[model samples]
Target: MKILILGIDGYLGWPLALKMGSKGHEVIGIDNLSTRKFSEEVGSDSAFPLPSPSDRVKEAKKILGINIDFYVKDANDMEFLKETIRKHKPDVIVHFAEQRSAPYSMKDYNHAQYTLDNNLGTTLKLIYAVNEIDPSIHILKMGTMGEYGTPSLDIPESPFVEANINNKKDKIIFPRWGGSIYHWSKIFDTDLLLYFNQIFGLTVTDIMQGPVYGTRTTEITEEGLRTRFDFDETWGTVVNRFCVEAVLGLPLTPYGKGGQTRGFISLEDSMEALRTLIENPPKTGEYRLVHQFAEIYSVNKIAEVVKNAAESLGMSTEIKHVDNPRIEAEEHYYNPEIKILPSLGFKPKKNLKDEVKIILEDLIPYKSRLERYKDSIMPKTKWKK
Candidate 1:
């Protein structure tokens, strides 16, 4: 299969490219390196040093013998994107090019607008480009479970729910209540994908994935092949932030009452799930909604797991409660379904403790590097300022 992965320089995108390339798929990658620039603007970076994208590509060929054609261009550029698609004619297009940080999106007006434009704009361009070039190409968009925003009801994997509003029995696209500008943009993308699928008969797969954590996948055999692991307040996921805090011997701070529960997946499992989906493309004009996550855990539980993992390595950190910066429920019902992946032979490779232990060991060697940005590890971006 020919696979074109946008944002291939990013954390998930880089590894996904390696995974596909290793499986003998012809892989094409594109990115503007905005994530690297965003990290610099936030006074932090990948805890481990990352080679340049070109260097990383060369390393993949050198170490893994996988060839990936990469382009350093923005996916929002419709002409360039359409030309590339027409040129490669890839079977599947994995879209990960977007501003993916909730806290960063909530920072300010410029940040919010940038998040909307970059995320939604890129998706709209991709939709039109695919429609113009090849409607049969499967677009696997990276969506977020954060779009649901802690509703009281159990979340289903199906994009639509059977609603009987005022005795009008009909199925409607599931309600989305995004928590931040970033999440709202993803919600917009979901709608765009569905609309395009309906109007232009485009094949789409919207992966409503949870927070992904873990530094090592099977494809990461050397330093240059490593994906980015951010641990700052703005860009870092909660698990990554906790692991970094534990490595630096700083307190593991959980927001508010520390009862915010959400789903999480390891990088390995995430890649596997994606690969499975790509191999099994949906029928023409079908929009497949998949809930991609391994386990459900509260923020407090994640902190505890990280703390225990660190303690096992003779590094100790206390769990501290802080005021929640985001306007979200600290405690809420969160039972999201996961029927698609398992039926497709997907199972979790590692549990939270094991994964955190691996992350701790990986970060122990980079303690000094983590220490340099320890000041930026705490919550500073507020939803209500």
Candidate 2:
């Protein structure tokens, strides 16, 4: 299978390219290096040192013997994107090119506008490019579980919910209540993909993924082949931030009673789930929404697991509950049904503690690097502000 991965230099994108290439798929990538720039703007860097994009690609072929064709171009360039699609004619195009940080999106008006523009503009262009070039190409877009806010009722496994309107039964897409501007952008993307699928007969897969953790994968044989691991307040996952804080001997802070629960997945499992989805493409005009996550954990549970792992490594840290900066539920019922991945041979391999331990050990050698950006570890971006 031929695969085209947008934002291929990103944390998830880089490794997925390697995995696909190793599996003997013809892989091509496009990235604008916006994530690197975003990290710099936030006064933070990857917890570990990352090689330049060209250097990383070179290392991929050198170390793993897997050659990945890469381009440093913006996905918003419709003509260039369409040209690439026409040239490669990939079977699947994995879309990860978007502003992914919730806190960053809430920083200010300009940040919000960028998130809305860059995210939506890129998606719209991709939809058009695929429609004009080849409607049969499967578009695997990366969405978030945060699109479906914490509601009182049980979240359905399918993207649609069965509703009876005045005793008339019908199925419709689940209601989306986004928590931040970034999540709202994703919700809009969901609707756009579904609409395009219906109108243009485009094949699409919208993956509502959870927060991904873990520092490394099995395919990362050398340091240069490593994917980026961020541990700042703005860009980091809770589990990743907690592990870094423990390594730094700082308090593992969980906001507002520390009861916010969401789904979490190891980086390795996330790549596997993506590959499985790519292999199983939906029919034309079909818009499939997949809930991809390995385990469900609360904010407090993540802090606890990281603390335990840190203590085992002789690094002591306390869990501190801080005032929540974001307007979200402190405690809520979260039981998201995940049936698609498992039925397709996806298994949950890494537990929280084990993966947390691996992350702590990985950060041990980069203690100085993490300490340099330790000031940016606490919450500063407020939803209200």
Candidate 3:
């Protein structure tokens, strides 16, 4: 298969590119190297120096002997996107391109606009480009479980159609009450994809992914000791954030009530589910929505795990219930159904101590970076009107 992937420099994008290339697929990656720029602008590069996106391609070529072509381009540029699509004529396009950080999105009005411009603009360009080039090109883009706020009701598989009356039944898309600017942008992407599918015969697979965990992969050593991504407030997810806090002797800053539950996935499991979905795609004129959650964890549960990891490193820890920075319930109901991926044969790895140990072992040398970002710990923005 010929695959064209956008945002190939992100945390998941880099690994996914390597994973697909190792499977004998011809992979072409495109990125503006924005993630690294964001990290640098915020003075928080990965724990270790990551090679430039170009360097990554060069290194992967040397190690795996799979020469993946990479281009530095913005997906929002419709002309470039269309030309690239026409050139590659790819069988699949995996889009990780978007401004993905919720906290970063809420930091200010400028940040919110960046989210809008980057997320919506990119999708619009891709949809139009694909329609102009080939509507049958499979678009496997990342959506977030966060798009649906923690509802008291169970979150079903994506896009639950409703019927009000037999006499008058018009189709309605599923509920998406986003809790942050970032979440709302993803909801917009889903709507856009659905629109294109109905209007232009496009095929889109929207994977509603949870906050993924784990630091190791089949290709990378358990103790690879590279600049594992941060555990800081700006970039880190809950589990990774806690791991860093615990490692650095900072308080595990649990916002609000510690019972806010969220779905989680391992990196290995995410790649496997994506590959499976690619092989078994939806109909060309259809929009298939799949939930990518593996397990659910609350603030308290994640904190406990981080504390345990810290204790294992021979350091006692602390949990600080800071003022709920955002206006979310300190504790809220959460139950999201993720049925498609497992049925496609995705086996999840649980929160094993050894996995946490490997993460700690890799992060041991970056304790100073953790300390440097500690002052930037507070949440600075919101999603509510």
Q: TM-score for model 3? A: 0.94
Cα misplacement distance, residue 9 of candidate 1 (Å): 0.7
Candidate 3 residue spans exceeding 4 A from truth: 165-170, 222-228, 350-354, 382-385
How high is the lDDT of residue 96 in model 2? 99
Deviation from native of the Cα of residue 3 in model 2, angstroms: 0.6
lDDT of 2 by residue, 26-102 (tens): 99999999999999999999987889878987899899898888999998899889999999999999999998999
TM-score: model 2 vs. ground truth: 0.99
Error of 3 at 345 (Å): 1.5
Q: Give lDDT for model 3.
A: 0.79
Each model's lDDT comes to: 0.92, 0.92, 0.79
**Candidate 1 vs candidate 3: which has greater TM-score?**
1
In model 3, state the lDDT of residue 292. Answer: 87
2 or 3, greater by lDDT: 2
**Runs with alpha carbons beyond 4 Å of true place in candidate 2:** none
